[model samples]
Target: MNHFASIARVPGDPILSLMEAYRADSHPGKLDLGVGVYKDAQGLTAIPKAVKLAEQRLLDSETTKSYIGGHGDPLFGQLLTELVLGADSQALAEQRVGATQTPGGTGALRLAADFIRHHLPTRGIWLSDPTWPIHESIFAEAGLQVGHYPYVGADNRLNVEAMLAALNQIPQGDVVLLHACCHNPTGFDLSHVDWLQVLEVVKARELLPLIDFAYQGFGEGLEQDAWAPRLFAEALPELLITSSCSKNFGLYRERTGALLVCARDTEKLLDIRSQLAFLARNLWSTPPAHGAAVVATILADPELKMLWSDELSNMRLRVASLRDGLVTALEPHGLAQRFAHISQQRGMFSYTGLSPLQVKRLREEFSIYMVGSGRANVAGIDAERFAQLAQAIAHVCVE
Candidate 1:
């Protein structure tokens, strides 16, 4: 017998596996609202116009192929910092902020996990109970114990009281992972007032807050979307932010993201940055160049940046409109009352509150695909299919 026979099969990813099943279905009206990736009205994921223009500009340049520093391109990091932290951010002005480019949001998360493990090895990580599944898995893989904090309530809203209770129980120095904006899966997010409360708790407990900002421009305007992270950085003595361009810039395949560490002391900031660079050296040597270059180009050019913001706002409005349409279409079927929560939720996803059996029925009967947990990517639905989707969901959800 071969000595290598102990390898066991790992299960497929739930979201991607659903995508494969959707593709294999030959049903003419099959709908896919499973995956987290954004899709336009035409159901296509096209590159942002700003990105296309930037690529053209890059093609005109004649740059060397020399290896970038372990922190990746310096200019790209600067551009990303300004884009995420704002031009007049006090953190940047005081030299208390440090950043490193990564493959994307996932890479940033992994890097942050490693940083936590190295700096605060004794403290575990606390995540929202129904946060993006990968957060817990990534932290656990980094040799950190992971715990959960209550987030969503039975009424399909943020359980602020319960979340506060959970936060109070967390030990000092523990890392608390927060979805800066656009909470995934459930789409329920904290209100500005709620954010202030959570910030107070973090400050009081001396907990480290790691903000995951993947869909910044998807819920609101870029500046408005960055308010939470900006506020946290300004108020908290220590913070870490993982910002991604995958969704807003449509650079998913390019894998563009940055990790920002904010410390009260400049000397400490320098030390943390060095450790991040050392980790990068071992992880992938250096980050990719193309995606960050494109983003930097767009951000550096005023005209291009304005155009990108306008396009992002349009996408946000369209998704919100689709959420409204779904509710309207389900009114006659008596599901409007039940699904009103969908319209109330923000960002690209909405937990439809459908039971597992109902989700299964939608797929088996109507060729409409959604996560078994009833999370639907609202951006995946267009005007042409809104009525059909509503009807399918309503039919399956009938008592």
Candidate 2:
């Protein structure tokens, strides 16, 4: 008997499948906006100069190949914790926050999901309706009950009121996943006032906030982007945070990320961290060290830190410019006002409000590739080909 015959082939991930299709297309003007990676104007995802410099320093310093312990690098944990939660964060001062290094933002999220499943087994996790596709699968794979709260609606806009209404109905003590900035899939983000309203509902519902800080510096200034998470950390007695250095530090492949826990006090934090460490040991004995080590080295050095910050600022500004440019380029087609939200939306992605049919036309008729949900990575746009892209989009919209 064939043992493998019982298993059925699974469908490929939509975004990844789109990538394969884009790669196979022979069109000279093919465009790939499916994957969420920061590409340069030349359409290359090159390593940042500061990251290269840090790697050279790491190479010269001569480090051991031995395991960095179950919790990963201590220096990385310390610095990354401060990077997300301000250095002078009251939670840090009060010894209420603890950090653990993970493979990547996805790993951090998985670790968090496992922790919730094992410890808070009775509580289900709530995600935004149009969250990153991986969010749903990750939690479900961990054997945890998953639910959704409204985020984007039929009108294709951030419906915070609907979101709060859904949150109000969810049982108390359940985990609520919130995007700190640069909301995935849909680029629409909750403003300060919206965050406050959500915070009130969280307090009333006694829900646990699990803030996902994947694109920290991409949406706005790093400091500015941290406002929501920091506010929750300060006000709430317990909070869970997953932060990624992939976008900000351009450390995508290195898989550098951290899961931070904020508790009522040092005693509670220690208990929570012990559980996290135990869970991480089973998931990924020890995370890859090179990425974390490089981040630590750069953050430790003043000059290198400045260089990284400047590079990060440039990437953020470039994405913003692309968003604006795409909208302006659509002006000739009289579609600028219709797609004006592209500029209003921050970060690497935007929901273009293109129907599935329109998206299909862009891929088949033109060579443009984006998710069927109309989610496009703004950072992937090549300014030189903006006019071509605009024409393709206008063509699809009109059809």
Give the per-residue lDDT of model 2 (tens digit) for 91-175: 9999988889999999999999999999999999999989999999999999999999999987889999899999999999999
**What is the lDDT, from 0 to 100, of the residue 38 in candidate 1?**
83
lDDT of each: 0.89, 0.93
* Count of backbone collisions in candidate 2: 0
For model 1, give the 10-residue run with minimal summed lDDT.
62-71
Error of 1 at 192 (Å): 0.9
TM-score of each: 0.98, 0.99
Q: Please, what are the lDDT tens digits per residue for candidate 1 over residues 1-399?
A: 888799899999999999999999999999888988888888998788888999999989938766777887788888888778898999889989888999999999999999888878898999997989898789999999999999996666679999999999999878899998889879888889999999999988999999999999887678888889999988977899998999999999999998999998899998989999999888988999889888888888999989898888998999999999999998988888878888888899998888889999999999989999888999889788777888887777767
RMSD in angstroms between candidate 2 and the native structure over all alpha carbons: 0.9
List candidate 1 segments past 4 Å from native: none
Cα lDDT for residue 367, model 2? 85
